[model samples]
Target: MIRIACLIVMMMAGMLRAEVDARPDARVAARDAAQRLDAAARQMDKATTAKDRVKALSETVHAYEDGLDAMRDGLRRATVQEQRISRELKAREIEISRLLGVLQSIGAAPAPATLLHPDGPVGTARAGMVLADIMPGVNSEAASLRAQFEEVTTLRLLQKSATETLQKGLVGAQEARTALSQAVADRTDLPRRFTADPVRTAILIASTETLEGFASGLSQITDAEGGAPLPDISHRQGTLPLPVQGQVLRRAGEADAAGIQRPGIVMATRPQALVTTPTAATIRYRGPLLDYGNVMILEPQTGLLLVLAGLDVVYGHAGEVLPAGAPVGLMAGDPALSGEILQETPAGMGIGSGNRRSETLYIEIRQDNTPVDPELWFETDKDD
Candidate 1:
């Protein structure tokens, strides 16, 4: 038991060390993205041609979006981890209580001398049996105690890492928010490549009822002129990042809040969390769709459409090009902190609704109007 405890302790320590080592490099990347965003903002302001200004705007938007997305992802991993750590700690408490009860039942006084050195045959047999049974229970409890202690130690290590990560994310977000605001304000006009064609407005406005129909019809229109370079999204299949950082609550074909299943994934995340793009895509539509709040649809290629819904506020509009990791919107949040937030969910709508799991993002990947699992596109950890 001691050897097992030591082995587990070593493993947990190594995991924490990996987290610490990886942090500095991530910080550097975030800093570089922020710097590039600032430079792009300046470039956008100085450019004389509409094409030059649009190119600068794209770079600026991408940088700001990437930085903000990274910061928000870090914050969410840290924040949501606090709840998991809290659960481990609670289990540790239960184990400790059971061990304490066992110890209490053993009593504070030593065994009587008469029982320990019984002279009669019957007395000796009874004493021997009692000792044997009691010794095993004591040993078992001791081993259990040791294991629980190791578990608690590992949880503490994770808690400390999460706290530090949360701090860094919050700090980075503060700085990025300022720079992002400036970069976005610098964007006044759409480049000719991103401009909306007047001929398609009537057709687009007429087909807002179904996401599949809207995506298909919208794709048939030309949002851009033949000037700007666009990404080949099909090749980025295994390389795209998740638009948001959270655990997947449901996958394609799973039932949702309304007891109706859809071809999408429901993500559980922190309230007011920022959402971004997984890859370079052009906005096809952004508006309300029935019971779902603010929705944004993006087309990476001619046939595949990425649908993101359940946002409180959306940023970019239809026909605008969004680079990878570009900010699209933020989730709705209560003013209270995580601990203070209450659950007032309706029946069947509370799949991932807990004290901290306050927001949900619904994601769907459609290829030529057919639904596909989004899990295959983004990298995921074993725990997730």
Candidate 2:
């Protein structure tokens, strides 16, 4: 009877051991699948271009899903191993206890030598020997458990890495999509076209010359602090340095009285107003050119360039330095005739009248050849 029982126990242990051994194979398969999935996801994230981005995102999602599935399978196998180990441990404990009880009942102390001796019935002796052999096998199962634990840890790490990588890829794709969409929207809403006014141009020319003179006078008073005379460009913002202030007949870079392409700011004032220099600088260029009639370019310092146009007369010559607010020139013709001669004169003449009755001053500020919008730099209120 004992022999039969021992055989049955041995068979059960053998079956349990077989199951544990099989678990490692399953765990390894799961680990491999997870690693592969993670690798594929990472590869997809590195793809460039729109098509590549789409492909990469797709691949990443697929890999992530596959990895998750593998991880789940791995965990299930680990659970099975844990259960097997638990059952085996309980059976081993029971066998150990039974052996100890038998030794105690026989008035014998439990010892390795006693366990190995074949003095008892064959079946009982075999059971004792088998228990000793199984003890080492239980430790082997512990190693397998440790391996399973390691697999779980590795799988979790892979899952986290893949997830983070996928998220970053998704974010990048979304941003690219947004930028592309915005570009399309901007293309559809083009800026409106604006016609220029020849009359406004004439006014700007007349006022520009008058302002240059005032700038020259100011330069003379303040020349002690500077190297050269003030440039034709006025430093004052908003109102010009002229005594007879006029309304802004037409805006710069906008539709004017006569249809023409105007590229700069225009300030209208009395035609009789004196032209003044704004800053202490030398006159660099003075002549009729393009939209600027009777133009005068002045260099105040090293980099500052002032341009005065549409003048009755240019007092300063090229390379000649003048004081700030000094009288550089006068607006051409009488103040009242600005409107009558609007059509009779040339394209850039100092005569214009359409929207408002006033002399126009064309002023531009340039730093290193770059034309900065004077409206932003100039103060809108009265100048100091």
RMSD of each: 11.2, 31.1
Top-lDDT structure, candidate number: 1
Q: Write the per-residue lDDT of candidate 2 for residues 1-384, one digit (tens) a residue.
A: 234334434444455456555656544755575575556545544543334343344334334434533544444444444445555555666554554454354345456554544556785578677666655554454454455446545544443443344344334333433333333233322221122233544444455554334333322222223333333344454443321134444444677667763544676654444456655556655556445566666665555556667765555444445445544555555533322322232211122223233456676666555555555444443231
lDDT string for model 1 (19-109, tens) is: 3344333333334444544554454444334444434444444444344344334333433443443454465565446545645554553
TM-score of 2: 0.31
Question: Which residue segments of model 2 deviate by more than 4 Å?
Answer: 1-244, 257-263, 335-356, 381-384
Query: What's model 2's overall lDDT?
Result: 0.47
Cα lDDT, model 1, residue 268 = 79
lDDT of 1: 0.57
In model 2, the worst 10-residue window by lDDT is 342-351
